[model samples]
Target: MAVKKPTLFAAPLANNGSKWSIGTETNVMKGLSQFHDPLINWSVESYSIDSLGESIALVVRNPSEDMAVTPRVDIYLVSADNSVKPKLLTGSFNAISDSPVFIKDGKKSVAREWDCSPESIVWSANGQTIFAVATDQGNNIIFAINATTGNCTRMTDAGSAMGLGTLGENQLLFQYTEQNKCVDIHILDIETKEMRRLTDVNSDKLRNVYIGQAEYFWFKGALGDQVHGWIIKPLQFNTEKKYPLALVVHGGPQASIQNIFTSTMWNSNIFANTGFVTVQINFHGSTGYGKNFTDSIKHQWGRYPYEDLMIELDHVLDNCSYVDKARMGWSRWVRVTAALVCHAGIFSTPGAWYGTNELWLPEHDFGGTPYDPKARSNHEEFNPERFANEFATPTLFIHGGSDYRVGVEQSLAPFTLLRRKNIPTKFVYFPDEDHHISSDVDQIKWLTEVLLWISEHTNTTLPYNLNQ
Candidate 1:
């Protein structure tokens, strides 16, 4: 059987005195363009040419067989003259090269996921070093890699570096954000490794606002690995009094909740300001730790992550004496909402094939399709529907009717099951919205409902009137 691979074509243009003419075209790299392995898939994410045009840097992505595993990313130096094959400059590391901008809606702000892309690379003036950004632990770190030796050195401290740009010859400019602070422009001196803020755009807007204090902590996970998480203390927090806990589960089972101010939908400060302690665990499958840690969730979804969450919760309860263990509730993003479903095992429903738009997601995470004989056991084992009989917690189901990623049926099915089981559950559906509630009105409604749900279950008072 012959395997068809994506071909990279290049067209050179030559200006013949008066007009431009298409010269003889050719394949960019011929047979060496993509990974030849039949089992693995690969692609060229981005490419850069040196100032002299003698060398080109290419970011290649070779995804793993398991979807949970971070794709192997490498920087290859290819000579323009085609005298030699592409040389591997850097070894495989989880690269988060794309820097997404922060989104603001009224007073609420959101930082989208640190997408992996080519924008993450900044070539030094001489083209001798490549400064790239990657997620480490929970911070978006910048690393200066030697173009020749591939020796990498960490550049920035603890914060999320959103995007990078060249600043003169010695410094790199980037937008950075921390858990307590909003996004600000900062400059990094690659030589001395000194970073200073260049702009404080939100200082005035936040001068009178109260933000929660975030503290990072780690505990032994299900696999005995050090799982990381964050705990945000409520506004006007006091050690003498106990506060309700809101266990917020991040989406992307593959993504990690970093030390950055996120969107209004999942903002930890919202809960903190509402007099609730907010906790977010990175769990086993979450990225930024390492490839092994990210790959640990393969085929074992719902198992390891659930175990890690429970274990981390226990750790928090044991250490944070001011947390009211009895008054605890949890909320999750769309995909991992299954984590909550796993808690009480929802009703048996069709697997990922029925509602999920991305087929590769289940194919990669579940080991195979739902109908595959070998994968059936895994699909059944991790399916939240399999555990429907165990559900006891009061739940609120929110879904966008137009959501193509995971159909609204995913929520409706569970909501129906919970209703049948006499468990308190509410379904909040937005017909016009997509995966995320984006509009200003919807955002307000979403947060209001979420806070109301948690307050009702935990017996906490709303910090402010939602009707206003």
Candidate 2:
């Protein structure tokens, strides 16, 4: 079989410019425009290559402060050229070519987007047709457009793109988002368009749930009337064992925690492997849901969602026989503090120093303030302060010292209050870390420490010596 040559097209750098400029390359956004000097405003970049060695097309970015999107991209091509009197092609909204393809001198031709700023094509497969997944006006869609004619077709419907992607040949994989925060994986026949669901691996009602492998069950959003959530549980969950539970409140009050691929968990398999059930709720306020749900969470921050968490906890506890109602976040935070008080582990510190076998991976605590609003859902519902004083869970507070999202301060507030209540608690700080712990080594070590803490307090058999 003969090997085909590589298909290469002009790849434009959308945001490349001088260092001092608030340019695309720098990813700097400014509310004010003043590019008369050393590039204080104006983002810039361009494309100047062609496959034929003769320049065919050109792309450039020119930014403006008037619009939310800076530096609108402008595309052009070399219409014609001569040694002395050369030619130039320029157009916005649409570009018209002066020559034909292959038979350049035969007829006039051109291709362009119906709306210049609506979509940007960075890559394309399947001939000259460019395919992309785009979210516009609160709907997600897969669009295929002709590179030559600029005509387009929208494939895949809203909600259907939630868990969609490629797996292997003749197959496309994806998950569907359910109203009450449920996600299910499905496979579509590329040729037939016939789709089959391989697994509802994350459903609470399943027997062989793909623990930690698939997205967890979705729950009603805390931020909205009918939003959803994604929940993760332990890998080797024992129905008989009453395990510790954690509701990882992710920030991005507007961003629904999607379950596609996440390195953010920081090798969280350790959490499941260690016998703890972790819940990551998309909660209300997440995107993916329509604008109504996303915007409902705008003014109402901490309050409504915590109640949502409580309700979900009750639902899980009632359904899953193994989850101990006594074994939750508030309880965990306090229990750990009590262990320190009673000096429960004589060998805990020693075993903890033993170092971790798993590789270090960074992690983070979830949650953040929603879009600024003077009004909140009855401060009582969202006030962690009130709950913090009474929280008796064996909780370990882990946060990024530099996290601007929910801020390390959020963790500090709860930890401080819980400590005052004489609740079991430990607040560990990763000095240079941010929202999601990025350093693998730190995550592993942090997780190991958490495991040891849980083991010692829960009366499980884990290494107590830090050196173990």
Candidate that scores best on lDDT: 1
Give the true-structure RMSD of model 1. Answer: 9.3
Q: Taking the tens digit of each residue's C-alpha lDDT, what string does model 2 give over 1-468?
A: 433322123222333465333312211112113323343333323444343534444343333323222223444444222112212234343221221122222332333533312223322323354444455323445555566787766655544245345555555566654323245677756556566766665455544433464344545545336534444566556667777664455544555444433334433344554566666555555565555555555435554555666666766677777766654542221232223211111111112112212111001011211211322223333444554445665556777666543445556655676688886778778888866667887776676666666666656553234445
Model 2 residue 180 distance off true place after TM-score fit, in angstroms: 22
Report the lDDT of model 2 for residue 350: 14
RMSD (Å) per prediction = 9.3, 14.1
Score each candidate by Cα lDDT.
Answer: 0.71, 0.45
Considering summed lDDT, which 10 consecutive residues are worst modelled in model 1? 101-110
Residue 158 CA error for candidate 2 (Å)?
A: 12
Please give me the total number of clashing residue pairs in predicted model 1. Answer: 4
